[model samples]
Target chain A: MKISILRKKLDDKEISAVELTRLYLDRISAADKLTDAYLYVNYDGAIKAAQSAQTIIDAKQSRPFTGIPIALKDNLCTFDMPTTCSSKMLDGFVPPYDATVVAKLRGQGAVFLGKLNMDEFAMGASTKTSYYKKTKNPYDLTRVPGGSSGGSAAAVSVGLCAAALGSDTGGSIRQPASFCGITGHRPTYGFVSRSGCIAFASSLDQIGPLADTADDCAALLTATAGRDIYDQTTADKTFDLKKSDKGIKGKRFGLIKELMGKEVDKDVSAAVKKAAEWFINAGAVVEEVSLPMLTHAVPIYYLISSAEAASNLAKFDGVRYGFRPEKTLNFFDMISKSRDEGFGWEVKRRIMLGSYALCSGYYDDYYKRAIKLCGIIKSQYAEAFKKYDALLSPVAPTTAYPFDKLPDDPAQMYLADICTVSAALAGLPSLSTPCGYDKDGMPIGLMITGKRFDDAAVLSAAGAYEKEFVRKPPQLKGVSEMKL
Target chain B: MKSDISIKWLGNLSKIKFDDDGLKKMAADMQSIMTLMDSLLLVEPVEFEDGTEFCGLDALRADTVRDSFDPELLVSQAKDSKDGCFVIPKIL
Candidate 1:
């Protein structure tokens, strides 16, 4: 059910908060066996929160998110639940406080279902790198839910939660949401605060929402977005959640010529074309625009993000809150052994790559050059935005693929981020909304990106498309047949 | 180009170690990624156009004293804590 409908039911007292929470927890108990969406299930905590919400509802002091059941990606810190980031490096570490977003949601009376799985330190595109269980696509169990936000998207896809919070470094949120057929939005870089979120690439990481629709994403974003004293990168502006009556009528959208290349699956390209046609038929203008710098977004994003990640991750030296080695020779040896054993292969690989990129001999040739190229990519987006209000492209080159399909080379996997990385590089607001289904009935996502801080406009464009598109839910194995 | 990158040197810089097999695997993976990074050379180093968004230092909130995490709670997550201090290997 949609958040709006849930609100109406909650307000009218058709069901108590406890009953609603129980229903969702039951669904998770049954369905998550196949999906493997949650890392920890906070059954008692959720029930206790539900009781509190019931009291508030009885007192007529309910807020926008009162009684809402939301799951957090494991990267977001929670005081009570473990925020492992699905990595052994943080095997048992729980923060003393909640992340800024989690705090906001809790203050508004949102029930904490559990922590969802994600890529280890948000390193890999597929959640396979997670030290925990791999999250499977609800649409097809054999395939992966795109990651590192795979668990968040999968949970929402299988009705495990009303919505989930996900972090996007390079296509993490949107790619998984696309694979699972949900709406995921990475708000403008600073639209949401990053305080207490386990940093991967500080410059690129933004916590976003994965929901069934754009309006739901807008509601979540509105409730959570604001300037935080803790996160200086947050914008000073407020996210005023007003109705966007300004539909796609007469608005101009650009179809990025670079994104719809031969690399994109024909069905995925077709879906984008169909979305453009829908816009054109709806009295909007659609044009093919070029951003050639986008072709290098993959390399540029990896270089810069890894460089930031290496620095951000230097804190995990085993002395403080994370996993520690039992036997070591000295302080240096302790830290080295702890890290070498604690981190997964992918995490270590990125750290090594990041260290090399920032090394004295290679800094200018790699990191500095990537930053300069990033500037050119951003300028290209600026040029395009001067004419078009938003751009349209496929979320991924293809629909969700079977496990172990890509070659062992990580570059082969990183290259799949071609379409979504540019928006992140430019600090633009990008969203993935289900556009069509592939031959195997897997959903394809059409990415809509707007200029920086034009987040509401980007969401409005997505909401417009969502209103007309018919959404179908995945038939989860044990839970779909059960009537709550 | 791949041979020039020393895995041992990077492992030392990152403070993470690798065995012989792990080193070989890390080297191979590093080579693949570096080859991908080489594509940046294809783009001419055009004049830098600082398109990065900046909130500026002026936007920072005034630093002020406020209640912080309770020391007891902060130290609770540490693997080894005694007398409100994290127990670490003695550097000396």
Candidate 2:
């Protein structure tokens, strides 16, 4: 259900938070068998939290997101559950504190359903790398729901939960949300506090929400997006929920010339072009712009993110926090054995590449040059932003593909992120809204991006475009409007 | 593929141990990924200073002591601990 409509229902006492929580929990239980979306279901904790939300609602103290059941991506630290990052290294490890986003959402009375699966340590483009079961797209069971926020997207798309929180680093959230046909937002870097979030790539990672509509993501950000003293990198400006008309008139949108090329599936490209055309018809100027450096986004992203990840993941050495081997002949042996047994193949591979990139002889050649190229890519987007109010593109080159059709090489999967990474590298705000379906009956995503710190405007433009998007997947079309 | 010695050295530096097959597979994977990254060198070089300054950092907070987590709380999370300290095998 949409948060705004549900808020009124909750406040009027037509439905208690406890009842709403039960409905979502039941849905998750029914959906889990098919989607493998949730890694852990915190039934007892959710019930207790819902009862508290009920008390707040009865007293007429409810907030925008109060009483809503929201699923958390496994990477967010929660004192009530294990924050595994879908990797065995942290299996069964419960954090003593909540992540900044969790702390904020809890203050607003949001119900926690459970933790959702993701790429192990948020490394891969597909949830196939998750330590738990792989999540499949709800539309077609044979195809993948993109990752590493695959579970978050799938759960939200299928109504397993009212909404969900997912982290984006190099398209983890947006790509999956596109594949699952839900709304996903990636706040500009530093806009959302990252404290207590298990770091994959500290510089690039930002947590946001995936839900039924752009307004819902905006509301989620209003509650959770802001600075935290704990995370020095958080931006100084907090997200304000002042309601604007969010009209599309008089805005200029850019369609990157490089992004519309042959790599994109014709269906996917056409759907985005149709969205651009909609803006044009709505009294907005639509122009084709150039960002040639975007072609280098994938390679540079790997170098920088991997380098940071290698350093960030070093803390999981079995000495403190997470899993540890039972036997060891020496201290070094203990750390080595724990990591070897605990991490999955993808996690280990990333650590290997990161170590190589940051190593003594290779540091300047690979890591340093990539950082320089990343700067050029950032300016390239910035240069376009100077001429355009917002930008548009396909979230990925194609819709969800069948698992058997995916390439054997990991690099091929990395290449799939070609369209989404440049925005991340540039630290710009971006989102993916379901535009239309392909001939194969899979959903295609239309991505909208704006300048750094121009997040609210970005969301407003998407919310304006979302009017025509009320046409949802056949299964989910009327689910949000269904009376409890 | 990376040289056998270099691959072994990287594993050691990263504190990871892989079997011979895992090592060979990882080396091959890294070689292919590196080949893709090689294209970045041809992009026109630009200036960028290496630092966290690009990310907006909040001004430093007051230095006054405040309520803090007990050391034992962190130690309790360790896989093995005793007497408020993490227990590990002897290095020597």
**lDDT of candidate 2?**
0.86
Model 1 TM-score relative to the real fold: 0.98
List pairs with backbone clashes in candidate 1: none
User: Taking the tens digit of each residue's C-alpha lDDT, what string does model 2 give over A1-484?
Assistant: 7888888889988889999999888877666788889999989999999999999988888888788899999999999898899988988888888999999999999999999999999988778889878898888888899999999999988888888999999998899999998889999898899998899998899999999988899889889877688888887777764564457789889998888899999999999999899999989999999998888889899989999999999998998888888877789988888888999988888888888889887787789988888888877777787789899999999999888887777678788999899999988899998888999888889999988777877788888888876545525322343348
**Alpha carbon lDDT of residue A458, candidate 2?**
77
Clash-forming residue pairs, model 2 = none
Candidate 2 CAPRI classification by DockQ: medium
- Model 2 ranges off by over 4 Å: A241-246, A474-482, B1-5, B48-55
Q: List CA RMSD, all candidates.
A: 1.3, 2.2
Worst 10 residues of 2 chain B by lDDT: B49-58
**Model no. 1, DockQ:** 0.72
Candidates' TM-scores?
A: 0.98, 0.96
Model 1 Cα lDDT, one tens digit per residue, A92-200: 7888889999999999899999999988998877798999998899999999899889999999998889999999988899999999999999999988998889999
